[model samples]
Target: MIAALGLAELKLLLRNRTAATLAVLMPLAAGLYFALGVGGEDDSWTMVVTLQLLFSFGFTVYVTVTTALTARRQDLYLKRLRTGAASDVVVLTGILLPVVVLGLAQALVLLGVSMAAGAPLPTRPDLLVLALIGGAAISCAAGVCTSGLTGTAELAQITTAPFFFAMIIGGLMGMSGGEDAWVFLIPGGGLGTLTGAAWGGPTDHVLEALASVVAWTAVATALSTRFFRWDPRT
Candidate 1:
C-alpha cells in the first residue's frame, strides 16, 4: 500500500513541470553554477559541495515536500488516504518518499559533480553519510511542520521561506569557516560541520554537530506530530 501510494506520488510529481523543476533541475543547476562558476583562491571545493547540499535540502527537499503536502491536504487527498488501509505513518511516508528519494539523489549528483570539478573525495565517509541522512530527515520533518501552517498550495512557498533561508544562510556562514559556538545551533549548521569534517576539517565538533541535527529533527518531528493537519484550512 505504501509502495503504491509512493508510485502515485512520483507520477504526480513528474507530471507537474513546476514541481519537477523544483525537485530536480533547480538544485542541480544551482549546484553546478556554484561549483564551477564560483571560485576563488581561498574558496574550498568542500565548501562549494556543502553549499550545494544546503541548496538541495532547502530549495529541493524542503520546498518540494511542503508544497506537495499542502497541495494534497488542500485537495482532500491526505484525508482520503487516511481512510484507506494505510496507517498515518505509512500514509505520510508514502506521500513524502518520492521527494526524499529525489532529494538524496540530487545530493549524490552534486557530490559527483563536485568531485569531477576537483573537489577532494570525502576524508570521512561516515560523517558525510551522517550529514546526508540527518539533513534529509530534518528537511522532511520541517516540511511537514511548515505545511501545517500553509493554508493553500500557493501559500506553501511563502510559509516555507523562513526555513529555506535559515538553512541556506546558516549553511553559507558555516561553510565559510564561521567558528562561533552558536553556529551549530542554526538549522543546517550541523550539516555544514559534518560536511566540513568529511572534507577533512577538525573532528572535535563532530559530536556537537550531530547533537544539533538531532535536536532540530526532534523539534520538527514534535511540531509536525502535534499540528500537522490532514484537512484543508478553512
Candidate 2:
C-alpha cells in the first residue's frame, strides 16, 4: 500500500511542472553552476559543496515537501487518505518517500559533479554522510511543520521563506566558522559544520554540529506532531 501511494505521488509530482522543476531542475542547475564554475582549492571546494548541499536540501527536499503536502491538503487528497486504514505515519511517509529519494539522488549527483570538476575526495567521508542524512532529515521535518501553516500550495512559497532563509544563513555561518556557539541553533549550521569537517576544514565543533542537527530535527518533528493539519483550511 505504501509503495502504491509512493508510486502515485511520484506520477503526480512529475505531472506538475512547477513542482517537478523545483524538485529536479532548480537544484541541479544551482549545484552544477558551482561545481562547474567554482575553483577547487580545499576552502573553495568546501564552500562550493556546502552551497550545493544547501541548495539541494532547501529547494529540492524542503520546499517540495511543503508544497506537496499543501497541495494534497487543498485538494482533499490528504483528508481522503486519512479516511483509509493506513496510519498517519504510513500515509505521510508514502507521500514523502519519492521526494526524499529524489533529494538524495540529486545530492549524490551534485557531489559527483563536484568531484568531476576537480574537487578532491572528502577527507572524512563518514562525516559527510552524516551531514547529508542529518540535513535531509532537518529539511523533511521542517517541511512537515511548515505545511501546517501554509493555507494553500501557493502560500507555501511565502510561508516557507523564513526557515528557508534561516537554513541558508546557518549554512553560511557554518562554512565561514561560527564566531559563537549560538549559530549551531540555526537550521543548517550542523550541515555546514559536517560538510566542512568532511572536507578537512575543521573538527573542533563536530559535537556541537551533531547536537544542533539532531536538536533541530527533534524540534521540527515535535512541531509537526502537535500542529500538522490533515484537513484543508476553509
Name the candidate that leads on TM-score.
Answer: 2
- Runs off by more than 4 Å, candidate 1: 39-42, 176-178
Candidate 2 residue-pair clash tally: 0
Residues 122-153, candidate 1, lDDT per residue (tens digit)?
88999999989999999999999999999987
* Model 2 C-alpha lDDT per residue in residues 1-234, reported as the tens digit of each score: 899999999999999999999889999999998887885666698888998899899999899999999999999999999999999989999998888888888999999999998998999999999988998899999999999999989888899899988998899888655557889988899889889889887788998999999999999999999878999877
- lDDT for model 2 comes to 0.90
**Model 2, position 233: C-alpha lDDT score:** 78
Each candidate structure's count of clashing pairs: 0, 0
- Against the true structure, candidate 2 reaches a TM-score of 0.97
